[model samples]
Target: MTAEAETTTGSGTTTTSGRRPGTGGVTARRWAPGTQVLWRYRDNAGGRVHICRPVTVVQDTDELLAVWMAPGTECVKPVLLDGSPVHAEPLATRYTAPRTTARARWTGAGVLKLARPGEPWSVWLFWEPGWLFRSWYVNLEEPRTRWACGVDSEDHFLDISVYPDRSWLWRDEDEFEQAQRSGLMGPEQARRVREAGRAAAEVIRSWGSPFADGWEHWRPDPGWAVPALPADWDRAPARTAP
Candidate 1:
């Protein structure tokens, strides 16, 4: 079977755009429902943001969910994913790779899980933050998608959308009907984020910058909801985790 053979789903990342999906180019594909995926996050400064594990199953409300038996320090909202070909999988993640070493300095956290005993690569980025798997210019990983969020982090806006191809397009989340407008994202920063996703696809793909790698996984602390952004704290949307 090819590496993309398994159709599993867990939490990773996805894109939200009305644009079109691409069909030509070689890039990493997403997992099918029932496959496990683990994820870790870091800021531009390379500091640990937070870690989350989502399942691939679509909820009654059409939301994707993944459950991790975490400690008490973490909170995960049933992440709301937008875009095509979503699925749910049943598998627990195990963060392999050492976390305490000089070389592992830049690598913060990751999940560890077992797959087919002999499966070649145990962990994969089921979903990314910006978009789903597939497409060329838009097929880049979410971590590498450079974004300039709304000023002051208010209004709760996701600057740009990413696709499997890594290509990108400008987006005005505030333009959405249900969107709650916040501060402004400088035009320059917006343009950069919109262009970055597409431009970085191949450059990063060539170096293999993936979402959930064995070396970065870490078991969550416990069950909880993702904290509301302080900027949007006044009007933070209610959270629901699976």
Candidate 2:
């Protein structure tokens, strides 16, 4: 995973930014093209994290790459042909579908930001593995802002996210209120989250993944070893001098 550029929020620390360009048309590519190459980078604190997820690049334009991962998206084996992880740590994070959330229930897109080590935000998108459904992004998730796009499974959309400090909270008012008390977001961050709702609505209008029977893409074949979890998955990250 790579940091395209470090963005400083009005707060301390850097807000790394990456914009998933607006998707093209379904005819723009193909829905569920192939196993797409996914680059994930995650750090528990400020150190390297367990990494995995790789796909071969078949075609790449200056803007996009037609990629695929062998064994498809379910290959959780810890090593690739080069002894790298089938998946790897991520730089920042994208969004994904939550396992328990019912589809078509997205109120809107949202965002959150924490400069220090703590729970990040939750983000969701609509994408497919075999083809590219560029019009809309699918998948729903909690801790939504912690991930980007990865693999589109057959049963549902499988997304990647940095381990979250806060757990998944269905769009209940309690969770919304907690986000306020947690000091995880600021006025600007909250505004961005609100704007994210536009993307969510757009995906819906386009009938994308998790929004478009993405639940069908959720099943993952249990084969290789899934990544091991840190001793504490829910602990907020602590800032350390690099």
- Give the best candidate by lDDT: 2
Q: Could you say which candidate leads in TM-score?
A: 2
Question: Please, what are the lDDT tens digits per residue for candidate 1 over residues 1-242?
Answer: 22232332334323221222231332323333233233323321223432233222111111122222221213222211321111121111111111221111112222222222111111223332223333112121132211211101111123333344545443433332122211223455545444544444333346343322222343333343422223221221222211
For model 1 the local lDDT of residue 184 reads 28
Instruction: Give residue 6's lDDT in candidate 2 (0 to 100).
Output: 46
| Whole-model Cα lDDT of every candidate shown, in order | 0.27, 0.29
Q: How many clashes does each candidate structure show, in the order listed?
A: 58, 52
Estimate the overall C-alpha local distance difference test score of candidate 1.
Answer: 0.27
| Cα RMSDs, all models | 19.9, 16.8
Off by over 4 Å in 1: 1-124, 127-183, 204-207, 211-242
lDDT measured at residue 118 in model 1 versus the true structure, 0 to 100? 15
TM-score of 1: 0.23
